[model samples]
Target: MLIALISLFLAGSSGGSAAGSLTAAGVLALVVVFSAAATLAVSFLLSKTLLRGESSAFTLELPPYRVPRIGQVIVRSVLDRTLHVLGRAAAVAAPWGLAVYALANISAGGETLLSWFCSWLDPAARLIGLDGVILAAFVLGLPANELVIPIMLMAYTAGGCLTEISSYAALSEVLSGNGWTAMTAVSVVLFTLMHSPCSTTLLTIKKETGSIGWTAAAAVIPTAAGIGLLAVLNCIFG
Candidate 1:
């Protein structure tokens, strides 16, 4: 699970335009170090607490090595893995896409639903060094992390649909125009590393655990840690 979260963070950070800058690379390295340390610390704590159990060791029987079948392997890879993941992502993203469109289009008393929702979340978001739009983006992006920046851009521009920036320069301009700063970027990176898993991941966890309690824990633990850490950072630096 920690590996999955770190992978997501790496993907997000590396995809940004700022990633090309030396300063951004340094920040990424720092975050990577922090992630590694946190993973080890969390694992140790879990072993001593929630995961305490009698030690047991078991050996697995090795499967006999077999020659690879290229055609069969390709077929299984496409049909089983690629299609399965895409299907699940589409199932979640389709509805979310519609909802986002509506939220951006519909308005009451001169405020779009998206704006109103962001306003409502603004106070809490500010505590974590993020704006309401960014928070709303993260919440709406629960379906897929890839939607986050697009959703944020749409909200910022009051666009009726997701807005895609074609270049990193444009993306950086939009973010800065919306008041993003170095601290904001740091906060965002931290939250990206620590926030809850995407919807598909949560569903998979629920299915694998067969327990709502564990599934909720999987979502909540990292989020709570993120909130706590950000709160402290804001207090110290705000």
Candidate 2:
């Protein structure tokens, strides 16, 4: 699941003009390799420690292939998968949208609520090679990963609403103006790959595990790992 989510991010990041750049492709490929290596290392360590047990072999009977039924396939795909995912996303994103609007618009002590919150996070975020606005965006983006960049843009522009970048050049300009650098970009990419899963994924985890403790772990472990890695990177590069 984590791999799939990371792959989606990589694909989206590479789209448009950036997709044609060899450097961009190489960077994304390296990210994929690192993710795979980290996954394997963690799985091996878990198997030898916390998940230790006698190995067991299991097999499943394969179903015979059948000719495709286009109508039935489309119906099942739309109803069972597409609608289910959209419904879950909407359930989580709706309240988040309102909360984001209020945070960006409401004022306290002559500062917007969102600005105040970002200020509060600034010290810790800087320690990880990220600024307050970037960290705030990630937190606000918990409902959906797709919202992260737009939220950052909104906050950066003081737009008090989600803002879209019309081009990669515009995105680069905004980020540069906000003090982004090579190290900052590296840290952001690492964090994006390792942060807690989205709201829907957390809910699904809770449902499947039937344990709040495990659900919390699912959120915390990856975040902790990301923070630890970012700290190391900052120490080395910042």
| CA lDDT scores, all candidates in order | 0.80, 0.82
Per-candidate count of clashing residue pairs (backbone under 3 Å): 0, 0
1-238 per-residue lDDT for model 1 (tens digits)? 1222222333354543454344445546788999888778866776788779945467899999999899999999999988987887788889988898889999999999999999999999999999999899999999987788788899998888889977555766777788877678778878888889998888789878899998998888888888889999999997
For model 1, the superposed segments whose C-alpha errors exceed 4 Å read 1-20, 54-61
**Model 1 error, position 161 (Å):** 1.1
Candidate 2: tens digits of C-alpha lDDT, residues 123-150: 9999998999989999999998888888
How many clashing residue pairs, candidate 2?
Answer: 0
Model 1 pairs in collision = none
Model 2 — which ten-residue stretch has the worst lDDT? 1-10
Badly placed stretches (over 4 Å) of model 2 are: 1-20, 54-68
